[model samples]
Target chain A: MTRKHLSTWGAVIFIAAIPIVIAANSPLLQWRDPVYIAGGFAGIIAMALLLFQPLLAAGRLPGLSLAVARRVHRWLGAALILSVFAHIGGLWITSPPDVVDALLFRSPTPFAIWGVIAMWALIATAILALARKRFRQNLRYWRAAHSALAIVIVSTTAAHAVMIEGAMGTMSKAALSGALCVALLVALNDLRVWKRTRPGRGITTD
Target chain B: MTKLHMNRRTLIASSGAVLATGVAGGLAPARAQSLAPTQSMRGGSNNYRPGAPIVERIGGGGFWMTGTVRRAGDGAPLSGQRIQIWAHTTEGHERDWHSHGATLTDANGVFRLEMPQIVPAFGQPHGHLAYDSEEFETVFLRPVMSSARDTTLEAHFVLQPA
Candidate 1:
């Protein structure tokens, strides 16, 4: 295989193996509750998707064009939303009071607070993305709002995953979370989304 | 050129700040919360069941949990039935938390488990016990509270046949 194809396939395999390895070692398997297992896996998948987002947005993935990356990024975003829904829904069915506590930000679990914040931020970002065309006249404002929400999503989700003790192994989870934060920081830096520009220059290419 | 250098330095500094905040926030010590049991805290239904009773013994201990397995309808002792028990101990590390074991009820349908002293951290002093058998629905009893002064806790299970 060509070197580029080899790299692409290697990356895909490596990414796919993360959750497989984590699920294999997870305590969820011992619990033997399908709903709980599904919820755990969904959460893992969402974190994995979050790792992909910045890479795609920053056009860092090898063998993929900017157009393909953007398309994949959009589709992945939708998949992330679905995964979050499944994760929360499964947890809700198993424990409605805990879910309510989480939503109300009164849960004693530190992870729940961060997870709820991230979920709401993710929903807001999705809504803003869907309503992009409505803000045609104020594209700059839309982009700024979108970027801010993206920051919240990444930050809070990373916090949520790191604090939880279940599912993903400690070292592997830490490594993935570290890589995610670095990728996001690099993407935001490259995009220069926060850089101040002349008043009339408008939004720079991202 | 100096302005460009300053901006680069600013970006690096801001990135470091953000990373520091994230890492610190994630690693913050978990605050203790009151032990409020939730529905989900009760183990899921998939692990529940009833079977013939058998006797099984666990460690000799700080606290004792003894119980009998019987049919809900007829009150007949379930002989040779399997019971699974797990609990958090006082000395266990946060990462290495929880103790577990399994045993069967004797001909008279009784089983006993011994637990080490449990120190309460995230919640109250409690443990989970499950009954698994082919003939009846699975039963999960969680957060079976124990007291520091009390040495023995009684936990009985009456199962409904499938």
Candidate 2:
């Protein structure tokens, strides 16, 4: 990798790892049960994965070729989905009623609303991806639908991550959330998902 | 390409500054409330029970949970409203069954319960109180004590009817 590529990768890794390291060292986690801790860490990991996603899709990350990047993106997507489930499931086990309230959109924290919205958007995007063969028929429509959900996921997840003063070290969490938004914005701008995406012309490795 | 690189560098540097500031400020200690109705908090339902036994006091008594329940707009005292209370305590974690209890407001809408001293948990010394009964719009309050050393933590609820 060139200096540019090396720096880009380093920055990505730096932003992604800082929160996990901080959260792992957080004293608050010592007071929490294993289930809550698992849930909390899964949430942190999910946010880090979000940072990789758009950069991968935009083929902006170092080393991985576009096709390889896209492939890794899919795998990471699966990992992201599973992490989200673990995050919610672990929390649900720890406190069913609170999780229920959050799922039902009655959670009192400002973060809960944003989290629920992002969670649903992520789920919806996953569902669409499953049936993306149909969407591949019309690249423009697929990009529109995918990009729209991506925006929702990016924005609301950022809101959700930042609003809660949780086990995650605050600064790293804020920085990660900020990077996630920037990654999505950069990806969207580079891909021009809102504009034409004629088949075979959507994603390319120049 | 240069501009994008500069942007990324700036982002990384700015984030570094934030991390430095946060560490200096004690790693973003626990704080804040809200986004709930007036005087009612959103996470109030945390550690709540629908019918925690109406106890003389929460177990391991030393701390007091005191508050007045009243109508939201008019401030009329709401008698007989069940206020569920729980907290991580010297006796047990708030998630423990024993650390939880309930009490009802008097004719004057005042309710008080004693429980074990609350120690700092999740980076703050706090207690949870909820008005989960159907009598009022449900409200949950997680009020942080200014100091864990304080013996009494009060949460006043001005609630709307369910």
Candidate 3:
């Protein structure tokens, strides 16, 4: 009902549904390349923060509480980074030519570009957070940077899902798409909350 | 809120019941679908029998051929299996899907024909299948076996790539 509630729920659902949504896509599972698998796992973990944040903020917990949720959110983020590397490495080992094309964004499909963009955004977000100690302690600045990059990561991952047409059968596709929709809704809810909370602020509606 | 909780309980129970029923109903068809005739169904071990004169010729491949073929389903040697292999390219060009190179199998289902030099095409340039009844369709054949073959020669095949 409230913006905070919506944001918390949205982030939790996003994170929790990451694996389910990715598994929905058939092609990802068929070949069993470490690269794609790792990538999928990482993407899910990254997206999970979107949902988990809201729930933690709302204080909906019985065990370990918000601290554990924050830890999970951070750990999943790290795991996601590692998984993405594994995914890229696997692809390089499996098909060097294809990997080259994917990196150059010259692959026959559009998903390559989306995947690459997502990776870059993820790395950028990670870098910002990691360097927060060196940087000024501006909560608004950190939040804006993190949220923008996170949105890009989720959006690109969703695009990757839409473009891939292999083993992730129809059910998998539907599941991932459904999850993406939920994440998008959560993001939109965040925007609405921001607008209501800070009228006439200079936050660009990206 | 109490009513909402009650409705949620009812909804959850009904969904669980429906899911259970759906799973129970779905298995038969799923099993049957998986069991349905795939390409492997056309040939199987134990179907090939011995006792007929075995002819060994090099099929297309990097190495010499050494294998057997038998009658479809029965394993009975057609005894002098005259196989005419001809088919379209892997690209399914205008050449048609029904024609591919062929050879014959003796009592042991062993027969090999030398492969002609084949130029690589955009997809794959090789003989395919021509005609067969619904019960027995002619399938694609590669000159050599898959494990240790690289030369795309049409002869001296250790096994049929199929």
Alpha carbon lDDT of residue A93, candidate 3?
52
Which stretches of model 2 miss by more than 4 angstroms? A197-202, B1-64, B69-84, B88-93, B102-126, B130-152, B157-162
Top-DockQ candidate index: 2
Write one digit per residue (lDDT tens) for candidate 1, span A1-206: 57987886577447546755876775435543567568767888888888878777767677777778878988999999999999999777655655777788876567788999999999998899898889887766776787788889888987887776566776777777777788788777766667555232222333
lDDT per residue for candidate 2 within B59-144, as digits (tens), equals 75988989988675456778998989998777766778888899989999899998888876533577898888886787778888
Model number with the top lDDT = 2
- For each candidate, the DockQ is 0.03, 0.14, 0.02
Model with the higher DockQ, candidate 1 or 2: 2
Each model's chain A TM-score: 0.87, 0.94, 0.67
Candidate 3 local lDDT, residue B145: 20
Lowest lDDT sum, 10 consecutive residues, model 3 chain B, at B41-50
How does the DockQ of candidate 3 come out?
A: 0.02
Select the stronger candidate by TM-score from 1 and 2.
2
Rank candidates, TM-score, best first: 2, 1, 3
lDDT of 3 by residue, B16-85 (tens): 8558868877524322111111132111111121122222322233222233443332334334444443
